[model samples]
Target: MQSDQLIVFAVLAATLGLFVWNRWRYDIVALGALLVVTLAGIVPPEQAFMGLGHPAVITVAAVLVLSRGLLNSGVVDSLARHLTKVGDKPWVQVLTLTAIVALCSGFMNNVGALALFMPVAVWMSRQSGRSPSYLLMPLAFGSLLGGTLTLIGTPPNIIIAGYRREVGEAPFRMFEFLPVGLAITAAGVLLITVLWRLIPRRENQGSDQELFEISAYLTELKVPAQSKYTRRTLHELIAAGGDEAEVMVIALVREGHYQAMPSIYEVLRDEDVLLVEADSDSLKRFLDVTHLELAAEADSKAEAREKAEQEKQAEKNGDTLAQPDANESKTDRHKERALAEAIVTPGSSLIGTTATGLSLRERYGMNVLAVARQGQRLRQRLGKIRFAAGDILLLQAREDQLPSTLSNLGCLPLASRGLRITAPRQVLLASSIFAVALALIAVGVMPAAIALVGAALAMILVGLVPTGDIYKSIDMSIIVLIAAMLPIGEALETTGGSRLIADALLEIGQSAPPAATVAILMAGVMLLSNVVNNAAAAVLAAPVAISLSRGMEASADPLLMAVAIGASCAFLTPIGHQSNTLVMAPGGYRFGDYWRLGLPLSALVVLVAVPVILWVWPL
Candidate 1:
């Protein structure tokens, strides 16, 4: 390679090395690379940030918005209710949920699929009395595997399809990847189910209590009953009963026994009793509400529930695994609330703060029902446990609070999971519009970019996706990275860096057979995917694959397939794929944790993919 090319190569290498080192934000790394190239005169100044406007960037943003709209409709949560009922057996639960999540990801966004299922998975972990750590990692990995199977499942696939078009060919058909992708998916899901067990168990594993430990129900209350405590004001109520039984008056019941929420000033009335949820020991000797009202409600249902438990113990004979699904006799529990999947940002103040201290309930009017920290189940004493960065917090709040609360918490909501199918009225319309756009692009009626832009405009005009949130849905970091890096890739090519890299591989494989060249291409692309972004890796490696194939005078399919397989196998590191990073905070995963599971998965992909690629598309 010439000196100028070497300079570009050196710049690209340093940029990627720093990015993997993660000393600075990845977007900054990409920008720095482009600036270095421009200052070095490898590329003109006009080309900097050009990739920001690329079609891939725009489409990714639009898709994210559309996914958010889907979440806002409450479709994903409803799916959880039905799914949790399949079976409570560990493998059975994993199989069913994994399949469900994968199917969800295949059609929708994979990240969304994982987000939607996260709560449900946590619930399952609680009901099963297992550590969530065992389940969540598999869930994350499964979602990643599923998304790779479909064109819309992941962005890299979309970018590859777009690149295929730019190379003077039609974009990939909707299911073009099924042949290789499905096989990879099958292998991946199986690996997770079986091999995931091989991962070392962490400290304090296996707690069923985490899921059931929803927000503490402690609230202030004026004692009332059918005259439980007459003539007591709200101020007097807390003082009288709070010592023996901890109760704060959150609200009041008023005249004619109306259960309207009360203000602080109201006096307790005759026959009115305060409602409270407290620890049983503290409530054992309480002087609050009339014993009759409190006792009656508990004995009727409580006795019956206790009797049912006894009967269940006798019938099952200590076999808890076969017990009914937690929601087998479910009621209408879901309400008009905003549910979101937010990752605790690395430097967030919310880490280590519980729901009470953060005033999530009092301030934001939301509840932090569950905190997914790495593989731990944190369902109990939530107010007391310190949160950490990288935990995926499952929050519930009024629809309006989501925006501000998220901003305050320094959390990034997963774009894909909260898809509410609430707008069933627009289901056909929204889906049809998306499908039409996809079809138009796939069939070459318009550039994928034009079709997506048109669809986004149409979606806005029709009120499918709201006009306000359209921009927020797109991941600007990714768009910026792609935009900044595309020119860098171009510079790499222009400066002959890519060619030198390609020649070195070809020369390295000179003594080996042509099949080995394909493996080298696959390995090289996989490394590229691991260090840079996956789509960027695919774009960088494709021409290299083609060039090496031409040099060896062989069919390019095997080599190209190698590049494709390697690019999408973003297993070894979080930076390789957004979905991987998306789960990091929620899973409480350290930057180094992914490679522990992913390194093997990536190797599996290369090994399985190489033989398959060679067999299916002979060299």
Candidate 2:
């Protein structure tokens, strides 16, 4: 009830409110809180930015980079192919996919793990005629469960370990979480296997119509006057699309005259609009190699001309940035391009503009293949189609530049079926580097952050990850959120806010047994995690758990374990975890759908994790 404590509590309350309101970005809100505390004299100005360089933030960034390397190497894809052989049984398929995603989560970032396997799950749902909702939630829940097994598995573990170091205890080792984590993960996976039946099977979830709502099948492009394809026959045009870009010319519209199903021997002409049926990747390659123009507003062509003029001016002025390496240019020119889908975020620059207006190819080295906007059929050309928030775009780009390109475009990648073009030797090299990092951490050769940073650097050195994209692989919002929350967490400790909360908990636990107290604390933290970001939950709860244990004169080990486990078990809502939200639109799921499986699975986690923690850590 001190004035300083009251001020800190008020700031904390506002921070939590903004997180739930979600009107503003979470990282912005967190940065605002950090500034408020520093200006109020609660946190010294000199220490205000210390959280940015914290080991936890560094480790999380490194993990994300390493995960991207793993994904690009095609190692996870090779392993997930085995699940396809499990046949069409829903039970067998769900268990197999969930187990693989969960197991991978123990070593890499769990959300990354979920991303890798999502397409596989959707593929299985299609093959088995099961609703995607039945499979996606279990995969998400399993990923959350898997992250609890290792110190580097999730950001919360790294943050909690950093907290332990600050309190004069050795940081938890790499496999310290395995005992309780393994128990809960094994039991939860089993329960999810049986209980997934409770997740209703929406008949439309796997329908062609639902799939088309997110991906368009046909697109129109104008034949440019200088194009080699102008004199070619319709049959020749189809042949030039290549296997990766297999397409069929469905119609020819010339000078506003629509002709359906042009004959194979029919000749093409300049300014003819060809209607074609093809996936995003194929369409891009066909158009690029054929030098066709997607119809666009005149502004797009003008923008491209302006950009080209700026580059020429820079070169004339001897701007070092304007020069591209000869060898690098040669390599890029020869690099094969592939197609992928990205959804425009609410904050995207692409919103309210057509792709041609954005000058995507000239600006970012990417081609917009097709766009899907629900409840509307596009009557215009691809480049002329105006984009809106939530429109999924199929883009074509060089394989190595895809991640950074997506980040730059403010888009989240969607699960798409395509073969990874990386060679086996490169994949092996990337996998070996990752294993070495894990081994170094397991033997205490270095801190987790240092080991991971080294591994990511090695991946770049070996050409597993492109040097230009090293920083892009790291999600800046996550880094900012971690940095900003750390000081807020420390302010809570210094202002005695943590102790006040601890004393209230101690009073309640005094009348109950220690085991019951642990369960109550665990349940409370889990609920807090569902409403707020899990990383913030861990940072706020760790100190209170330490105080609660001291007040009870019990081992701090069990209490800390409780906090770590509870902080990661976010379920019961899509907003609770990023993994859940990633699957919502793809699965065609509604808001209330999560509670059917999440509520029971959450109860199972508390029931199994409490006994395992008490027995292993011994309160």
Candidate 3:
């Protein structure tokens, strides 16, 4: 092999190994690989960062923002709310849910589509008395299957289209994928609906109450007359507890009037009651630091005895007394506050930051009452617990501020409580702008990147998506991964590395039929996608697929189609796609649970896709 080819192969091998290892984020790994290849003189230094401006990167980012616009307008949510009630049968529900999500995934970001329907799935599970595990995996897989339907549906499709444009062929249009994609999606959804029993029935799958049990941690604290913190400001009292204390004051009751989400600057007065949320150890530490006593124990012994005597006398007189139910009392206390259950979104800024580190209570006026991950509640100190993308957080904030707070934190509310439905006029405007963009792409008047970006900008200009949230809506990690990997993919072809690899594959399949060879190539890409980010899988494999097709003297379109379809079949593991991870905790799924349904679906895709590709593209 030539020295340049050797260098490219070595760098790519290391990159693939690091991706499989997954110690670092995929974006960081891709960026590091780009730098190594540039410094080694394989790619010129001036062009090292050129991938940042690639059309695929721009298209992917724009699609994300547009998806956020659709979500904010309540168009998608309204549709989901209605569709989730289509039927009572399990098969009908699964089929309808998967089909709708698939259709949405074709037009918007697949993860966003899955997010919009997750709460609906949970609600359905509750209504039908079935574990969410039966429905969630199918929903997640449906999103993946749907992404194969359109250019803007997923990163892999966009990357493949950009590759075609780079290779002197017209890029694939918006609906060109629809023919084959529709077939594959229909087959996959049917398989999921029929074989739904393959998915494990996990316990406590969709019940937030069972997962967090946050009510047990809520207690009332009273400031007594002799306490040193009686006259101190709320901020001072919190500061006294130190960073290790994870206590949160949800509301203050003074003179029997409730104040929700009280400001830190508010003064603590004698006999004021505070509703606090904390674990036992943190509650004890908070009490020790602030000299606060439990409200139930605050009364004198004589007063307690008198109250007990009154209750006994009333019972003896056979009089009906009005006694508040425990659950009702707790509900009434929190009527002015909002307890939101949200999942940290992929690429959220909150990931890797602890509550104390972010000053969530101080800066955002919200408290992290509890967190759950992969089906179990976290038992560590809340202040010190670093957030992850799929972690479910029990957050306490004011009822009115919950929506914007969750938005700013890069979290998606899992319940309807924090969801905002925009004005009908705004919704209509957002829909019109999106439709115009799609029309432009369909007519070839504008490229996918320009049309989508224009639509995103229009959303911002018209106040559909706020100016402050545009950047937040885009998943920068995905952008960086695509942009950084583009150059490396080009380097692989430029250095003849892809040609060498193609020759080896051709030699191995020298006697196999063309259809079998295509299946092998697609299966290889499918397995690679299961181990790494699907976008990276497509970027690295597209060049090789092109080379393989050329070596076999066949049409490159069929091979590229294989690459696109195979790149999106990341159904074997949660780490394969963000959609899978997002549903893992809520479904209470284990690592082994995926392949039970995924393996068969993958085999079916290979069986169905190869003939479909040949019939459509004429390999």
Candidate 4:
């Protein structure tokens, strides 16, 4: 082994270990690896950042923005609304939902597609009175299947195309993947639809109350005349509870007027009713410290009736509920407060941060009323709980700011029923722009990245995607991961490391038929993807696949296609892909639950993909 190969191999091993350790973020790990290799002189410092300009990275970012545009246009939402009419059968619902999400995944970011449809799937589960577990896993698997359909569908396809270009061939055409991808997707979706029973039917699948049981922790307390905190600001009152207090004051009612998510700066008055969320210990401590008492059941019932009568009278007068006083400005009437449930998205910055650390209430003006993970409410101190991807938060915020807040926080608001359609003109314009870009790519008139970027820009210009949201729509962590990992992949090939690894793989399959070698290669990459990010798996495996092809005296196209298909087969674990992770909490899936369906689907992909790849891009 040459010195450079040894160095590259060491760095690669450490990088993979870090990825599997799942401690640091993948992007940070990749970036650190890139810097290490560059400093070691394995890759020239001058060319270290060149991967940032790679077309694959550009296409992924553009696709994300375009997906947001499609979402904002409400075109997909309109289509998803009709899913309720798809009927009550489990198989029919699974088939229809998976197929649509898969089709959408082919054109846009697969994770984005999955996020958009999750709420709809949950709503469907609720309406049909079934476990969401049956629908969510299939939905996630479908998104992965869909990504195989286009060059821009997933980062791996674009990365594979870039590798093809390096091998002196035209990059894979936009729909060139459709032939093999369509077949694999068809097989996978059918298996999921027919073998839906493979997914575990976990309890509390569709009901938020069952999942979080918020009522168990929510207690209404009152500030009496002698309470020391009565005249202080809400912030001061909460501060009085000391650092160990886990309670949150979610709402305040003063003389029959309700304030949802009242500001912490609001002053507490005598006789005020506070709706608080806290565990038993925290509630007792908070009450002890603040000298506040739990509202009597009689007072609570009377207050409920009084509030209901006020709402009834307001409705009779054609006024909005929670009407502001005459002295209040019109802006107060339009404040539109709401309490909603949101799930933390994969790659969210909030994953490791605590509410106190982020100053969520002070900064985002939202109160974290309660949180649930994997179908059970968390009983620990709320302020100290570190957020994790797929954790469900019960948030109270202004209705208008909720969307952007969730977007900024990298969370997805759970669907609350019904579809909201944007203007017809925006819908037509967004669809037309996307169609034109696809047409351009199909005819070879423009490159995939350029055409898609142009389409994204057009959407921004036309207000289909808000200017404020363009950057937010792009998942920068993914972009950085791809950019940073690209040069490392090249270094593996350039340093002869890939060839060295390829030689060993070739020896293992020397006696096996070439078709078996393809299966082995695809299956190996598939397993790697199940642990690491799929794009990183493709990057590391692409060079090895290319080298393996040369040693076998075969064309590189079939091998590269295998790498592409294998990279997207990140089933068998929630951590394998963002789509899977995003559905875990909502579906009440355990860590081991994935493989029950994933194992079979993975096998099906290998069985269907190898023959199709051989027939389409023969060795």
Candidate 5:
């Protein structure tokens, strides 16, 4: 081998070793590899950082932001609400979940789609009294399968298309991937659904039930003056809770006295406090659908007096105190407030302190919505409750205040998500913008990267996704991993390292048919993807595939398509895809657990994708 090729090979070997070792962050390892290659005089100094500006990198970032906008607009939530209606039948549940995730993956980033549905899967497992392991792996695999169906479905497809342009060919059209991708996805989804029994049944991991198992949240809501059910019978009101019977109406308070187990026949009156026991999603849905307002917690006498004095002084100074509005415009509240849960750490100063003592609402512009403590049913007022070290608190605050508030309060954030009700109009607007971007790409009106960037910007301009969260939505780790690895890939090609590898591969496949050669290349990429990030694997494998195709004097389309299929089918290990990693904790999955189902599923992908690619692209 040439001296330059030897250096590039050494650097790449070390980089892959580090990726599998996983001692440091993948991004850090990739950056180290990039620096080593540049110092080795392979990649030019001026072009070292050019990968950061690559069209593939920009497209990935834009897709992530658009996915977040769809999430924020409640598109996923709307779909999940429908999924919950399917009963406890495991087959029905798995089919519905996999299909939903697959459909979402086709249009958005697959990782984002998996995240949106993970909580739902956990909740479903808990409700069905089944192991979450059965559902999560299938969900992860379904996402991988679905991403193959569209050009923007996954990063590997975009990278392969870009590489085609470098080889003096027109880029693959948006739907060109759909044929093989759809075949593999459909076959894989069906196989997993029937064989999910192969997945291990793990214990103690389905949901964030540890923090919430104590009891449901108990809180009070007052019947607003504009409520349609002001004079409705309690029986009628409870019936309005819909099919969900989890939430219970605990007690009713009228005229400052607790009504003695008020019967369902009793009428609900305006300004009367009704104490309800329910989980966060149920409670939010009940309140919004019923038009009930959260009752303000009573402050201590001294605090109330101080507030009255401040109001009097303001009146004398010709100033009016603004009453907080329940119907406040979220656009006006541009900071985008949110409801989230946090647990007080063991050494937190918040321990043993009451919300009233901390003056949390006045000082931090935050509200303690509910608190959950072990072995306790907290029916008391939220503000008067003294927090414990292990207590989980449901808090309402601006999105920007969350990290700082959690850090300052010495609390750890929990994975237990809270619910938000997005207006239908917002969902329509965001979905429309996303659709137009896809249409632009399909008709060749614009390139995929430019079209998606425009869509993301429109989402921000229309306030579908908050401007401050645009950067937060983009996964910087994945971006860094891709950007840093691209230079290393370039160095390999520049040093003729890819040709060497390709020659070796061709020698091994020389006795085999061209179609078999394509399958072998696909399997190699899939194995590499199982250990490293899929995008990095694609960048490294693309040139090798091109070289192999050149050696055979055959079309490069099938070889490139094989790389796209292989890189996306990272099913053999949890570390292969973010979708797989996201489910590890919630599903209580071990490292060895993935191969049980993934091994067969991955083989099936190769068995199916190879013939489909050859038939469709015609090598």
Candidate 6:
């Protein structure tokens, strides 16, 4: 090999090593490698930054935005809610989930599809009493299958289609990939539903009963006229309640006015309602002994408690305590449980969606309490500041509705998913729009790049993802990786590295039949994909396939298909795709677990994709 080619190889080796080690963010590592390549003169410095603006990179960013718009429009939200009723019927659940993810991916980016559907899968897993692992891998795999139906579905397909221009071939026609993609998707869906059951369940994942476990309760205390405790200090009440009640006067509500969290020595007064955080057990004891009825707690238990208390007080006061008017008490009870607190989780529903915009109070009958901003408490008006991925929110709901409200909004309960966003809607929407753009491209209505970029702009129109977040979703690391590796791939051709490898394969199986040649190419691309981005794998292997064809003086279509199939079949590791990285957190997975199912899935793809490619593409 030429020394320049050797240097390129060293760059790839170091990049992969660092990627595996995860010493730094993947994007930074990729850029670092690119810089090294530039300095080493492996890639022309001008072209070194070319990958950042490559059509593939631009298309991915735009597609991501479009996916966001589809979700923000509530198309994905409505679909997810419907998925729940059908999500838990075992094999039926698999079919439903697979079809949804696959169909969604066909129109959006694959990662976007998986992200959109991940919550539903998690929700399904909890509802069906199954591990999310079962559904997530299939959802991810289904997304890949779905992407193949169109040119813009996944970056690999786009990259491959785009590269066709190098051969003086028009890019793949829209729906050209559909027949093969559909066949593969159908077979893949069948395998995942049947064979995915073979994957062992993970431990430490929270089940349904544990999903919404509430660790804290925030309620309001109404200071009534003639109440003997009205003059007490915050410390006095806390001391009296002991461990039974821990009190912080979050706010004092007077004449319907609210204050941000109050101070420790804040004096109490008649007609003032105070928001306090205390255990349910202690709060109940205090209410019973002191004769202050919890008007709010009863929005559920309120009716029974208020009546019982009035009857008891009537016997003592005779006149002042006659049954408190039922309507009056109902209103009071509804108003009672007015404050609740939950820590926002990284994956929370509130991350991208806003409270005022979502009609949270009207739709879910809940109100925003004070927001807890980790080391910093929020001073901005709670309703004005947009909810972020990691900010904690204190909310108020009728005590009885807390569980359902939390679950419905896709917010993980504070005790469990503190300060993390659990909402997957943005991801889902991003995927859907991406898929649609692909459909448009596949049908030849527009160029694949234009279709994808349009979808991303659509995302901006709807607000599913923030302006800043649009850039955040691109996975610059993968972009860099692709760019940096593009030079390495160039070197492979320059030094005959790919030719050298292709020559060995042709030598071993030169006489073996066409099918064997297909297999060798398939294996080569799959191996390369495991260690690099699938697009890079396809790009590197494509020239070799063409070279091998030149050597054989035969048809190269089968070889091309081999590279395409191998590029998408990166099932053996989480590093293969962002879809896999996404599930890593929720699945509670170790890096090793992907191969348990991925290895066989990959083998199956080769076994299946090869024959189909040969039959369809011809020798």
Better candidate by TM-score, 2 or 5: 2
Off by over 4 Å in 3: 206-209, 239-246, 284-291, 299-331, 416-419
- The full ranking of all candidates by TM-score, starting with the best, is 3, 4, 2, 5, 1, 6
- List per-prediction Cα lDDT, in the order shown: 0.63, 0.79, 0.87, 0.88, 0.79, 0.65
Global lDDT of model 5 = 0.79
Residues 1-619, candidate 5: write the lDDT tens digits.
Answer: 3998988888889989999997777888999888888887788889889999988899999998999899889888788767778889888888889988998999898977876677677678878878777898899889999999998899999889888976789888788899999999899888888888899887554433553342346666777665788888876786786644334555567766664335667888877777666777778788767777776543234347877998999989999876655434222322233556565643456877998699675577566766765423365655568986546677766666776677567664544453357689988998999999999988999999999999999999998778778887777887888888888877777788888999999899889888889999999999999999899999999999888888888888999999999999998888888778656655667789899999999889989999999998887
Candidate 6 regions exceeding 4 Å error are 216-440, 443-446, 454-480
Once superposed on the true structure, which residue ranges of model 5 sit more than 4 Å away at CA? 206-419
RMSD of 5: 14.4
The residue-by-residue lDDT of candidate 3 on 34-89, one tens digit each, is 99989889888989889889899999999999998998888786677686558778
TM-score of model 2 (CA atoms): 0.77
Candidate 2, after superposition: displacement of residue 599 in Å? 0.9
What tens digits encode model 6's per-residue C-alpha lDDT throughout 1-619? 4787677667767877876675565567767877887898767777777766767667666665666566555566567667768735678888789888887787676766676677677667876677776777777778877887765566666666655655567766666666667777787888888887666576444353332123364577776677776787644554565444434344556665665444445666776676655556656766665555453652436567867887888888776643445466334433444444344433345766667678575577566655544224455544466875335456766566775576455444332221223257655666676567667775678886787677777767657656765755555545666666565556566666667777888898867987888888888788777766676677668778867766777666667667777787777776676666556545656678888877777777777777788787787
Candidate 6, residue 323: CA error in Å? 8.0
- Estimate, for each residue in 354-415, the C-alpha lDDT of model 4 and write its tens digit: 98899999999998888888877887778878999899998888777888888889898875
RMSD of 3: 3.5
lDDT measured at residue 459 in model 3 versus the true structure, 0 to 100: 91
What's the C-alpha lDDT at position 562 in model 4? 96
**Candidate 3 lDDT (Cα, 0 to 1):** 0.87
lDDT of 1 by residue, 156-216 (tens): 7666665554345566656666667778778877777766665444434346343224335
Poorest 10 consecutive residues by lDDT, candidate 4? 326-335
How big is the positional error of residue 237 in model 6, measured in Å on the Cα after superposition?
16
| TM values, all candidates | 0.70, 0.77, 0.93, 0.91, 0.71, 0.68
